[model samples]
Target chain A: MSSVSDRMLTSDPVVEVENLVAHYGSHKVLDGVNLTVNAGEIHIIMGGSGSGKSTLLRHLLGLRRVTSGRIRLLGHELDGVHRSELQELRKQIGVSFQGGALLSSMTVGENVTLPLREHTRLDESTMAIMARMKLEVVNLGGFEHFMPAQLSGGMIKRAALARAIVMDPKLLFFDEPSAGLDPVVSAELDELILRLREAMHMSIVVVTHELESAFRIADRMTVLDCGKILISDTADKVRNSANSRVQDLLNRRPRVEELDADAYLARLTGE
Target chain B: MPIWMHGSWMMAETRLGRVEQLGKRTLGLIAEVGYLAALLTESLYWIFAGVFQRQPVRVSSVFAEMMRTGVSAIPIVFLLSFSIGVMLAIQGIHTLRTFGAESQVVIGIALSISREFGPLITGIVVAGRTGSALAARIGTMVVSEEIDALRVMGIQPVRYLVSPVLLAMLVMLPALTIMADFAGLLGGAVYSAMDLGISYAAYADRVISVLKTGDIWQGLIKSAVFATVITLIGVANGFSVTGGAEGVGRATTRSVVLAISGIVIADMVFTWFLNR
Candidate 1:
C-alpha cells in the first residue's frame, strides 16, 4: 500500500478522462475536459460555481452520459460499456455526495450496510456486524441506530465516509466534503480523508472549491475553469504552477462595488 | 389617409387570430393530456396484471407499505376529518334552522362526509403530507445521485422505491378513508351533543339512518384514485428535479401542487361518474 504519489513519478494512470464533453440542453457544461488520477493518490478538482467540476465527477462515476469523448476507469472504456456493465464497474468505485446524502429514511447502520446488502449475499447478522465495524472505523460506533437527519454535519459526513468505504472500493469520489463546514471541521475532514486513503490504499478524487483543503489533502490537483482544465500538477508544483486563471482563483481580495450608477439609472429609465 | 377604418379592421382581425390560436393551442394540449392519461392507464393495468404473473406478489413489501401509509397517516387524517365534521355540523345547523329543519343537520354532515368530504379532505392532506414528503425525498435523492447510487447497486428505483410507496398508498388509502368517515361522524356527534343539546345516541341514529353502502364505497373509490394520483405526481415531479438545492426545493413544491391538482381532477371525474 505504498503512496501512489511516490510511484506516480513513473506509472500508468488509474483513471483517464480525455476530451470529455457533456451538455445540459444547449449549454456545454463540460467541454474537452481531460483529467487523470494515479493509483493510490489523492486528486483534487477545484472550481468556482458552474465551472462543471460536479458534472465532471458525475461523468467519472458514470452517473451522467458523456455527450462526446472518452472516460476510462482502470483501463476499461466507460463509453463503450453497457448500462448493466457500468453498474458492475461502479461497484469497484465509491462516492460520497455533496451533502453526505445518507438515506435519511434509513438508520446510519442501514445506510452503511446497503452496498453490502445489495452487492453481496451476506446474512442479516453478518451484515449488521460489518456495518458496525465500518461505523467504528469512522468513529461513529454508537450512532448506528440514529437516523441521518439526527446526525450533526460532521457526524453525517463521517457516517457517509463509513458507507462509502463499506465495500473497500478501489476508487472513491467525494463531492464537496468541506463546502458548508467550518475551517477546523474542514481540516479534520481532510485529515480523515488522508487517513482513509492510507488505510484502504484507494485512489481518491475529491471535487471541491476549498483551496486550503485541496492543498492539504491532494497529492495531485486539477484546476477546472470555464469547463476546461487550467492546471494539473503535483501539489508542490501546483503551488507554483503560475497559471493566471488558477492564481486568480487562489488569490483573494475584497470585492468593491464599482457600479456605474448613471448607466444603471439610464437602463432603468429605458435610455 | 383615413387611418381609423384600416386600424379598426386590423385590430378586429388580430383579435380573431389570437382567439383562434388560443383555441388551437388549448385543443392540442387537451389531446396531449388525453393521450398521456391513456398511456398511464394502460401501463398501470399491465403493472397490476404483472402482480399476478409467474411470481406471486410479495405480500411483505406491500404490507409494510400499507402500514406506512395507513398507520402513519391516521393522526393527521383524524384531526382533519374532526375539524371538517364540526364545521359541517355547525354550518348545517345554522342553515337548516331557517326552515325549521335543524334536526336534518345530522343527516347532512353524515352524508357529506360519507360521500365526499371524507375522501377529498383525506386526499388533500395525504398530498400535502405524504405526497410532498415522498417527492422531496426522491427529488433530493435524484439531485444527490443517491437514486443513481441505488441503480448502480442493481436495485430498480421503481421496484425498490416507488412500488413500495405506491403499494402502501393503494392499500392504506381506503383504510384511511374509512377512519376519516368514522372520525367525521364522531366529530359531528360530539358537536351535536355539546352545541345542540342532542343526545349521542340520537345523533348516531340520525347518521346511521341516512348513510348508505354506495356513499361509503364512493368515498373509498375517491381515496384510492387520490392515492394513485398523489403517488404518480410526486414521483414524476421528483424524477424531474435537476441541478442542486434550489431544484430539489422547487420539485417538492411542484409535486404538492401536481398532487393536489390531480386529486381534484380525479375526484371530479369520479363524482361525475358516480352521479351518472
Candidate 2:
C-alpha cells in the first residue's frame, strides 16, 4: 500500500542514451533521441505506429546499429565495443518481444528455463524450481507443460514476462505489453509491472502505445512523435504538458493541419 | 538526327545497358557467395571452438535434427532407390540379351547401386525433404522474431540453430546412403531371381565378387559431401530470408533447388575423379 515515491529508489542511471540517431536505409527512424533510465525505474515510451519508439528500443537493445550518437547500458558503451563484451553486457538484460516470442517447439516451462539452461550449469531440479517460481509469480503456475499456442493472449504475455524475469535481469525491455489485451488484462499487466519493479529492484523500459497502461505504471514517461521526442518527464508533468502533439496523443485527437491546395491537387493528379 | 543514326544509337545503347546489367548481376553474385562463405565459416568456427573448449555438443538438438533429417527420410529414400534398381535391372535384361551376357546384370546393378545411384538418389530425396524443411523452419523463426529474441538473450544464434543441424546432416546423410545402397541391392536381387532365373545365392555371390569395398566407400564419401552442401545452402537461405511468410516460401524453394544442384555438381566431380 506504499506510494510509488515511498517504494521506489531510483538513484543510479543504468541506461544512458545520448543523442541517439538511427536509420532504416536512408529513412531516419530515430532522430537524435536521448533517454535515461535509473536503477529501479519504470520508464514508459509512448508513440503511435511508425513513431520510431520501437526502433529506439531496438537500438537501446543493440539489435540495430546507430546512425550517430552513443548508448551506454549498465556502464558499457554500445558503439564499437567488442562483440564478446557486448554479449557479456547482454546477459544482464532481458527483452519481452511484442508477440510473446516463445519458442513454439518448447513447453512453457522449458521456455522459462531456457536462459538458465544455456548460461548456467545448475542442477535440473534447481532450474525447474526456479522456472516454476517465476511462472507462479506471473499467475501461470501449473501451466508449464502447455504449449505457447494453448495460452490466451493475456497468458502468452504473462508467460513471456515470466521468461524475461526468470534470469533476474538487472534491466528489462518490454515492447507493446498491452497491445492485444483487454482492458482488465492490461490493467493486471500494469499491476504486475509495478509489482515486478518493486520486488526485483530492476530498471525497466517499456515501449507501448496504450495511454491508459502508460499513465497507470510509468514512473517517468516519454512521448515520441514522428521519430522525435515530444516530451520526457514524470507522469504528472507529462500528462499536464501543453504541447499540442502530446495533447493530441493523450487525448486521441487527430492532428489538424491547414489545407494546401496545390499539394492536394498534385496528389490527386498523381504528379 | 538521321533515322539510321538514331537506330544505331538505340541498338548501341541497348547493348551497353545489357553489359552493365550483366556486371551488376556478377557483382551481386559475388557478394552473395562471400556472405554464404562467411556464415559457414562462422558456424564451423563456433562448433570447433565449442568442442575444444569442452562445451557439450547439444546432443538433444542434434539428435532431434537427426531424427527429422535422417530417420524421417528413410521411407522415401528406400522406396525411390528400390524403384531405380528395378528399372535398371529391366533395362540390363534387354541390353545384355543381345550378347547373351545377361549375367552381367549382376555387376551393373551392384556396382552402380553401390557406387553411384545409392548416394545420388538419397541426396536428391534429402535435398527435397530436410533442406526445404530446415530453410522454412529457420526462415519462419526469423520472420517471427524468435531469432532476434535469441540474440537479445545473448545466445549465439549460429551455435544454437545452425551447428546442431550441421552435425546432424554430417552424420545422417552417409547413414541414409548406406541404407539406400542395401535397399537398392535388395530390389535388384528380388527382380533378378524372378525375371532372369537367377537365385538369390547366385546374385549375392556375383555382388560380393564385383562390388569392391572401395566402391561402397566412394558412395558414402560422396554422400558426406552432399550433406555439407545441402546444410550450407539450407542454412544460408534461411539466414538470408527477408519479409514474412512469402519470404520463407521463397527460401524453402531456393534451398531445395540449390541443394539438388549442388549435390549433382559435387557428385559429377567425384565421379570424374574416381574414373580418372
Candidate 3:
C-alpha cells in the first residue's frame, strides 16, 4: 500500500464512518469499510455496479441500518437518533439522489420550499421568494410551476439540486450525478458542482461510476471493489495509482472473460 | 419421463406454489391490517381534533375535493341508478300486475331507493372511482418517495394526504347517495308516467306514503359507513404498495374490491345491530 500523502488529506473530517458493515438478507454489501468526508471538500466514492458505494451513502444518510460500526455526522452519532432528530440532521445535509427524486405531485416551487416550510417559520411569500432564488441558483429560474413529469431529465436534476440546496446545507451528497446524462450535460453538471462548492464552501460526498465525472469534480476519491476500498487518493493520484482494479476501472478496458464455454456446453448437452 | 407426466407434475408444483403464495399474501395482509388499525387509532385522534377543534377546518379545500368526487361521479352514478330503477319498476309492474296490485310498484321503488339501493349503488360506484383514485395516488407517492418527502418535510402524510381524502369521501358520499336516490325515484316516476300510463301525482303520492324519516336516515348512515370503508381501504392499500406502476395498479384494484366488500359487510352489520 502506498503511504498517505501529507498535503492531499484534510485535517477536519465532517463525516466519519468506522468499521462500517451493512447487509441485505445474507449478502454483505459493505464489509468493514472506513471513510471520512471533511468540510470544504468533495469526496467521491467510485465503484462498479454492486460495489456498495450507494449502500455506504445510504448509511451516511441514515436511510439504511448499519449492521455494525458507527456513523458520525458533525460529531453526533447517527445511530439511535430519534426520527425528528434525524429529520433535523437531514435538514442540514443536502442529498441529491441518483435519479432526480422530485415529488411528482408537487411543482418545482413546492418541492424546493418543502424543506423551508418544514424547518422555518418564514411566511409563505418569503418562502416562495427563497425557493425562486434557489431555483435561479441551479439555473432553473422561472420554471417553478412546472411539474416534475413535464421537465426534461436535465431540468429535473437541476430542480432536485435546487431543492437539495434550498436550506444551504453544510454537507451535500450526490448519488451518481452523471449516471444518465449525456457528456455535455454531465460536464455542465460538473461545473455546477464546482460552482456550488466554491459558493457555499460545503462538503460534498458523491457516489458515482462515471470515471470522467469522478476525476472532474472529486477533490479526493475512494474506489470500492468487492466491498473494500481499492484505493483512496486525490484525483490526480487516483488516476495514476497502479492498483489493477482501479486501473481497470479508470482505464475502461474490458477484463478477460473467464468462462470455459465449450466445457460448460458439453456438460449441458452431454455429448 | 413422458411429456404428459412431466406436465402434470409441473402443474401440480405450480398450483402448490400458487397456494403457498396466496397463503403468504393473506397472512401479510392480515398483519398489515392490524398494524394499520393501530396507526389509524392514533390518526383518528389527530383527525378529530383537526376537524372539530378550535382551529378551523379547511372547508374550502374539503368542499373543492367533494366537488371533484361528487360532480365527476354524477353521470356514472345517475346512469347506473336510473337503469336499475327503471328495470326494477318495470319488473315490479309486470310481477304485481299478476296480483292486480300494480300501484304497489311505486311503493317498491321508493322502499328500495330509500332503504338500500340508493346508498348501495352509489357506494359501489364511488368505490370504483374515488377509492381507486386515492389508492393509485398514494401508491404512486409511495413509489416515487413523495410520501417520504412529506415525512422528511415534517408533514404527517396521514394528516396532510389521507385526512383530506377521507373527509371528502365522508361528506360527499352522503350527498351523492341523496342525488342517486332522487335520480332513481325520478327514473321510476318517468317509467310510471310514460310507460305505465300512470299519472305522476299517483306515483308521487304512493312514494310519499312509503317514505319515512327512518328510511332516509338509514340510507345516509349506510353511505357514511361505506364512505369510511372506501377511504380507509384506499389509504391502507396505498400504504402497503411496494413497487412502481405495477404496484399502483394492483393497489387500485385491491382497494376497489376491499372497499366494496367492506361496504357490503358494514351494511349487513349495521342492519343487524339496528334491527336488534
Instruction: Encode model 2's per-residue lDDT on A1-271: one tens digit a residue.
Output: 2255334544657888999888889998888898887777788999999999989988888888898999999999999989778878888998999999888889999999998888788999999999999999999999999999899999988999999999899999999999889999999998998899889978889999999899888888989999989998888888999998899999999888776999889989999
Candidate 1 chain B: worst-modelled 10 consecutive residues by lDDT = B49-58
Local accuracy of candidate 1 as per-residue lDDT tens digits, A62-91: 778899999999778988787557667777
Stretches of candidate 1 exceeding 4 Å from the true structure: A1-14, A74-83, A146-152, A180-188, A236-271, B1-68, B75-118, B136-160, B180-218, B238-257
Model 3's chain B yields a TM-score of: 0.85
Clashing pairs in 3: none
* Per-residue accuracy of model 3 over A1-271 as CA lDDT, tens digit each: 0122233254567888899999999999999998877677888999998889978887887768899999998677899987557767777888786667787877999989977865677999999999999998889999999999999878888888898899999888887888888999889998999899879878888999998888888888899987888887677888899787788888887656576999879889998
How many Å off is the CA of A22 in candidate 1?
A: 2.6
Can you write out model 1's per-residue Cα lDDT over B1-276, one digit (the tens) per residue? 379998999999999999999999999769746754654454354347634432223466677767766788899999999999999989999999899988889988988999899999889988998788877888988886678767655455665677667777887888889999999988888888887899988888787788888899999988888988888778767877898889888988988997898888888888899989
Kindly give the stretch of ten consecutive residues in candidate 1 chain A with the minimal lDDT sum: A250-259
The regions of model 3 sitting more than 4 angstroms off are: A1-13, A66-69, A74-78, A231-237, A240-242, A253-271, B1-23, B35-64, B151-155, B195-209, B239-244
Best by the DockQ measure: 2
Task: Please identify which of the two predictions, 1 or 2, would achieve the higher lDDT against the true structure.
Answer: 2
- Please state the error at residue A115 of candidate 3 in Å: 3.0
What's the lDDT for all of these models? Answer: 0.83, 0.89, 0.83
